[model samples]
Target: MTSSQVFLSIALPFAIIPLVLFTSSKKIMGEFKIKTWVKWLAWIATVILVALNIYLILQTVGILK
Candidate 1:
């Protein structure tokens, strides 16, 4: 259960890091590139998700309480 918890919280969300990068890259998306504001929002959301995942991992490992 602990491994499952860690995998779910950490491994799964790691994909978003690349997703945002690829989507925001003008060279990658060209005309479909994400707008600047939306790119900023995505980065902000990615940061928040990473922070929350770190918190989750810490709590699961009994380091946060």
Candidate 2:
């Protein structure tokens, strides 16, 4: 259970972070680039997810209890 949690928290963010970054990049996405508001929202969501993942890892390590 713990191993699964670690794997999911770590892997999920890696996948999502890149998606947000790439989509927000004008050079990479060209005419398909995301709007400023959407980019900000995506970044905010990404940061929250990452922070939650970090908290989860700390909890799993007995550092947050």
Candidate 3:
């Protein structure tokens, strides 16, 4: 795969997962924790990214046409 695709399909999910987790953690952010709406948005975005990554893996493995 191309470098950009590798970054988008792999590295981005890894980076965003931690960001979502950290931002949503009460212990991590204390009083500055992300708002409910923002947290939901981040979670939704993370889910989408994860789903896309799964699709990419399936395609690479020839499970997807």
Using TM-score as the measure, the top candidate is 1
The Cα error of candidate 2 at residue 11, in Å, is 1.7
Order candidates by lDDT, high to low.
2, 1, 3
- Tens digits of per-residue lDDT, candidate 2, 24-49, equal 99899999999999999999999999
- Taking the tens digit of each residue's C-alpha lDDT, what string does model 3 give over 1-65? 66587557877777898998998899999999999999999999889879989888778767998
Candidate with maximal lDDT: 2
TM-score of each: 0.88, 0.87, 0.75
Q: On residues 20-64, what C-alpha lDDT tens digit does candidate 1 reach at each position?
A: 999999999999999999999999998998999999898888899
Ranking by TM-score: 1, 2, 3
lDDT of each structure? 0.88, 0.91, 0.85
Better of 1 and 2 by TM-score: 1
RMSD of each: 1.5, 1.2, 2.0
User: For model 3, what is the C-alpha lDDT against the true structure?
Assistant: 0.85
Model 2 clashing-pair count: 0
> 64, model 3: CA deviation in Å?
0.7
